[model samples]
Target: MQHGIHPAYRPVVFRDRVGGLTFLTRSTATADRTVEWADGTTRPVVDVEVSSASHPFYTGNARVLDTAGRVERYHRRYGRGDGAGH
Candidate 1:
């Protein structure tokens, strides 16, 4: 609760790179530019590559990689006999 040393914390706009959608939230982070928000006021704007609303994992595009299959394939190709049919 110090007076003049703390950075300002207020609602700022965060724009999603893919959708160009902007949302306002409070943080002490600074932005290189400012933007007019949906509420008719201008605030500092930060361009973000991903957010929970825009990330592929949260949106269900997460890939389940088959590491076990890759390891088995590698061993089958390089390991000694008791050979697996090609």
Candidate 2:
């Protein structure tokens, strides 16, 4: 609990342009841009590339990795190493 040593934590807007979503939250992060929130107050707006709205994992659009195929391709490109340690 020190005075004048902590960054100001205030209501900020995190915008996800790709998903066209905006949310207001409290954070220490600030931005030069501003946006009018649903409450009719203008808060510092920060543009984020990935959010739950646009993230594949969160949206249930994530692609399943084919590890077996990758291993086969790798073995094809470079012969599988011998049992002997190299």
Candidate 3:
């Protein structure tokens, strides 16, 4: 570890906007916004679009992509031998 060359690491709150979830963790990232946490202290808050709370995979709401079907359709439409090494 080097001294005086690293970004400051401190507790930060990541807030998931869609799911309304907050997680407290240490990070070197900075945010201009601050939020009052449950523990009655204010910390820097970062707004995120997605997190485990609302992510489709983590929430078991994911839609299974029909990749094979899509590939087959693409092959049929484009004549499969278009230089993909078969």
lDDT (Cα, tens digit) per residue for candidate 3, span 1-86: 99999999999999999999999999999999999999999999999999998999999999999999999999888778868865
lDDT by residue (1-86, candidate 2, tens digit) is: 99999999999999997988888899999799998888888899999999989999999999999999999998888778776644
In candidate 2 the C-alpha lDDT for residue 11 amounts to 95
Model 3, stretches more than 4 Å misplaced? 66-86
Candidate that would win on lDDT: 3
Residue 39, model 2: Cα distance from true site in angstroms = 1.2
Model 1 deviation from native, Cα RMSD in Å: 4.1
Give the runs in model 1 whose Cα sits over 4 Å from its true position.
78-86
Q: Give each model a TM-score.
A: 0.74, 0.76, 0.74
RMSD of 3: 4.3
The TM-score of predicted model 2 comes to 0.76
Where is model 3 poorest over a 10-residue stretch in terms of lDDT? 77-86
Position 71, candidate 3: lDDT: 93
